[model samples]
Target chain A: MYRALKTKPWISLLAFAAPALVFYVIFLLIPTLGGVYYSFTDWNGLFRSYHFVGFSNYVEAFTEDSRFIYSLFYTLKYVLAIVILQNVIGLGLAVLVESRMRTKALFRTLFFMPNMFSVYISTLMWTFIFSTAFPQLAEKTLLHFLDQPWLGSSSMAFVSILLVSVWQGAGYLMVIYIAALQGVPRDLQEAATIDGATPFRKFLHITLPMIMPAITICAFLTLNGSFKIFEVVYALTGGGPGYSTEVIAFNIYQEGFARDMRYGYATAKAMILFLIILVITVTQVAVLKKKEVEA
Target chain B: MRKRSLIPSSLIVLLLIIVTIFFMFPIVLAVVNSLKSQGEMFKSVIAWPKALQWENYKYVLTEVHILRSLYNTFIITILSIVGIIFCGALAGYKLSRTPGKVSAFIFFLFLSSMLIPFYSIMFSLIQVASGLHIQGSVYRLPLIYIGLGVNFAIFLYHGFVKSIPRELEESAQMDGCGQLKTFTRIIFPLLLPITMTIVILDILWVWNDFMLPLIMITDYKSYTLVLLASTFFSEYSTEWSYILSILVLTSLPVILVYLVFQKYIVQGIADGAIKG
Candidate 1:
């Protein structure tokens, strides 16, 4: 039995890996490769027969398709704002909630309530707040800014989507940051306090570095998540104001399934999105990991 | 010194209270307005309704098949969680135990796709699912979720299995048990903590997932709660009373789960994020 196990260890490994591997390969791996392959074809998603179109689909996305280009930039802009805002707000809330001696759990639960609901549910709730409650509140009071066309107008729609995204997502990162904060030793803070450091100075020199790993994770999450944001945009604005709020994922969804059904072209756009996320994430992690080590 | 610090402490407390209000605004507004009549809501959005509008909730519950949608969501969430945990634990255990070239390669293959965005694969995923005739069926969606979700769960389980001692499993095998039997009896029960983490994360994920069902499920009869609520929103766009009632109903389950499992859910999210 020992000799048999030694001679064919792969048999056991194969047995263990087979179930997951089978499902993964069929649903995830095959479609991924198929997506890459079809990006080079002119398949319109209906007909099985198609011709290889080289890089023309990619070329059109960058050059001729202005909506795709616009959506790319729009998504990038949204991602930048979300990454910065989500992390900063998340860390802020974490620090505040952590510092409190009482009401900490209450605040944490309240903040995290939105995170429990689905993104669409969160957005839908916010939509009513923006469209209905805000207007009424504004009319009753002097808060004129509240009465602006939130999901209807251009600038407000962006603000509305950003608000909802940050509101839903920040609490999640706060939980992460809170975990990291708890991991930081009390001795370090006491040491810093004894060294005549102010609270801000301690947070800057001690607390921040101690929690760099969580920050890195939060940044990575926000970057990856905000880039692929669809449900929020889809549920809230539906890429309205004539696609002003259209992120790359929403644009791809529109091109492939909703509007044109241009599977190959849509695949090309999806590839671009995948590559962007890959490159950006790689650089971000590499840089952040270095910071983590240095700290 | 205490007197001097009081001002700063009060300021911080004030800021926190304001932030809490901001966070709770939507939920409070939704619930409050949901109980108001249409005329009452239009008159004073802030005021409590003079009379409760059970009719709004009644209409949504009875007419829109909200219960059916909730049942569908429950089915999809449970099945996907079961599928992910079972497949992932098996693969993760084996991969971690066996440290050969084949194991490393397969593990690496699973981990490498972690960077591939879901949108990148979504278009082609639809094609593959349709070809397999699993697109419209609610029952089959969990199978696809298992495929998509197993890698992360495997990664989690693989790391977790490391912390568990191997001697227990070996001793179990030394006795009369077969490999699968030993794993089922010895290893899996020991993996309960990580399993809890995985279950919590995936329940939150598969339950809340919108894009997958939106693309895969075309039939109205099979709509998940979120999709159902969303379609209801669009169809009855101006019916705020009905919409708010449905929205409140839709968010109730998750909120209840959160209230019940708040500690574990929070820990599981942090655990999953940090580990992954």
Candidate 2:
């Protein structure tokens, strides 16, 4: 046995891979496969038995389920907003903060401070600000426009969710953009400056091109995260104002856990989300990667 | 030119400071209001409490058993971290060292699975967990975390191990150390830096994670810090003092961890995001 093990390298790989593979399979792999399988079933999650429904669940999710379609559109809208805004704001902050000589680390820490809190916690805190503090500020100060029903109306709740997400998430992307910005050669920027390029010109020509890779990563990360947004909507508006703020994940969650134990149906919706995210992120990454090479 | 630039630069600094306050508004507000009576908080959400109402915190701690929930969170986070590092390092190191069709295929398997969102598998995961009789137990939950978490950790370690020279491990093996011994004794120690990176990233992921814990843990006693705070907030939505205090308590550990390991956490995040 020992001699055979020594000769066969597969044995060694098997030994090392087993521990992780066992857990991965049990927790991640099996469930992933099982989720796809169940997506075709009519399992109510009560009985051991389930019948194969064969794409009806997917059909129901798309055609019959208006809420699902609404949420899909809403989530796409959110993903678009986040992908654009978070990257822009994050890149802006990163550039601004990196220009500081003495206070770079301090500002980075302050910006990233919100990221340390759970998304749930951050959203809850913002709920108070929107629900209570905003009204107070609007009442007593010049910020009267803040007195809108931040979480009580559909449009307002959408804006409220967007604000909280960007507030919590921009800092994270900022950190990434800073790291990427530091990679751009200092001499190149100095040369551009010596050629009488303004700071904005230098940034646009030299700095932005250099950080394209980071931009791609940030865009993908933001895309993935915003598509999977649950905590913020759950905490702030609870997808209320008549489910107007319901994103795909929240809708799936409601189906499986809250509304009914429609495990198979929820799994189908989840699979749709997975496919959407996979296709979009892959396409975005591929396109951005080509940009990186060109730059 | 110098005079003109000075105005813009100072203006930029002033703008940043203002934005900084806007960023910190929720946290500062939460902390300030947590220390006030409900009546005092009602009078002015922005004002410093007339007197520090320690009872708000005391009530959360005593009545809500915040410490117990903190313990549960720590137990899950730490154990999961330990498991992830060990399993990830072992698998990553071995996978890196031994390159062939099998290893390549296994690595690809992990890499592809990274694209599978948690929600997709969550419903089925619950079924599997209940079937395995591991659901609703705090201790057993981290085992699932290790499974869910090890992929990224492995991805990190697999990349990191390529940087270490193979000669050191070969020399250790020549010294009569078995593969496992060579890994634990010789290879593992060299993995400290990347290990620290993985540890910090996973701590942040596991500790601050809300969805998985909310799904796996059903019993009140087993609720993680985020779950507990969320449940409490929903139940006591009107109790601002109590809710704010619990929010502060829930967030304090991660904030402390961030402040203490600012450099590593930041570096880890950058590295993890770019590489993984």
For model 2, the superposed segments whose C-alpha errors exceed 4 Å read A1-7, B1-7
CA lDDT of each candidate? 0.88, 0.89
Clashing pairs in 1: none
For model 1, report DockQ.
0.64
Residue A250 error, candidate 1, Å: 0.9
lDDT of 1 at A101: 60
* Superposed model 1: Cα runs more than 4 Å off: A1-7, B1-7
User: Model 1 chain B — which ten-residue stretch has the worst lDDT?
Assistant: B1-10
Over B163-249, each residue of candidate 1 has an lDDT whose tens digit, in order, gives: 988899778766766788888999999999899999998998999999999889999889999999888999999778889899899
- Pairs that collide, model 2: none
Candidate 1, residues A175-218, lDDT tens digits: the string is 99999989989877777667777778788888789899988888
What CA RMSD would you report for each candidate? 1.9, 2.0
Q: Return model 2's CA RMSD, one decimal.
A: 2.0
What C-alpha lDDT, on a 0 to 100 scale, does residue A26 get in candidate 2? 97
